[model samples]
Target: MTGHHLAVGAVLRRGKDILLISDPPDWALPGGSVEPGEPLLTKVTQETGFTSVLPERLLWVARYPAAGVEYEMLGFEVTGVGPHDGSGSWVPLPEAVDRLGRMWFAPIRDPAVAYLTGRARVATLWTWTDLNEAPVTHPHVAPA
Candidate 1:
């Protein structure tokens, strides 16, 4: 059986902008893996240093292969968050596509813009063969 890397991320929004974590030159959502008996939202807060409300529904699911391992990233629509301490900052929605250029992974960035801006209605799925290649988007994909 092939090993799989499963992770959950929150698309925290503030008005016309969204939250992004600066992980040493890389930008991404505030989230992490699902520990045994531990919730996804809890992991998000721990990793990103931001408090977030439970998402109303799943937003997206992305899959890609790298170094012989299959990676799966789940995205959720976090309704809100508590005060942040500058660890991570917010970026405008309209400018996110340009600002996130090469600074973050596409799987996370694309869905965040789509969902936050109301382009998608439900959980989507994405897959790609190469990290540099564009991902195939399937919006509102049903859960497996």
Candidate 2:
């Protein structure tokens, strides 16, 4: 809970397939640490190699403590770009969900996926004091 690591990730969709890094039985979104003052979308593009303009929306924010550090993940929804030289495969949503469920990081969960697929409302934001603890969800409200 002392150290803070902030990262950004994106779910790039094309037709019925979503872009994902091939991690054997698991998969990962295109993202990495937010370098000093680096834009999240830029980081995503650098990781995924998608250069065309796409609609990007902030979808979720997750906070969890792991390996004696606090980790914050920002997830986004975006339209897919043309093929790139990245190391990943485009898979259908169902397959993407299965792989994300098995990822080493805390599962991105179905609700988040649903949001990305435009099948559900934006998910409640979540925070956890420890990786092994249950997350606390907060509803979003606009300021008056």
Candidate 3:
């Protein structure tokens, strides 16, 4: 669909800390929209300044609707993080979960937690509904 936007995010870790960028009152992953024909690793490196990264797996795929567009966000488990250029903070996993749970796209919180905690067996599919209050999750939503 023309109204759909594709984004890629990395679950970058340093021991027990996860990388998160400040999105004003909320925090988000260190990645951005993926351009056609561009490598996913390139986007992660550009946003996070991690020149050396190894993508472990795809963690989650979420369809989040905002303002009339649907964002198809793909989260990946990336390892081998080298030096960072001070772009984002390395927060503890628990703290990062708390911060992400309160973000605008709150639906991402649970899936991210599941993956980080070694509870996820496969990449999850999520549908997010914004009810003007807080976003809610509908897991394994069927594709249209």
Per-residue lDDT tens digits of candidate 2, residues 30-129? 7768876776577677767777426466777887777888777878887657777664688898888767766765635533554554544454476777
* Candidate 2: segments with Cα more than 4 A from true spot: 52-55, 80-83, 107-120, 140-144
Query: Which pairs of residues have clashing backbones in candidate 1?
Result: none
In lDDT terms, how accurate is model 2?
A: 0.67
Candidate achieving the largest lDDT = 3
lDDT of each: 0.71, 0.67, 0.73
Q: 1 or 2: which has the higher lDDT?
A: 1
Candidate 2: count the clashes.
Answer: 0
Ranked candidates (TM-score, high to low): 2, 3, 1
Residue 62 displacement (Å), model 1: 0.3
TM-score of model 1 relative to the true fold? Answer: 0.74
What is the alpha-carbon lDDT for the whole of candidate 1?
0.71
For residues 25-130, what per-residue lDDT tens digits would candidate 1 score against the true structure? 6777778777657776787777556565667678888888878888888888776567655656788875654555445666666666566556666777788879
- Candidate 2 collision pairs: none
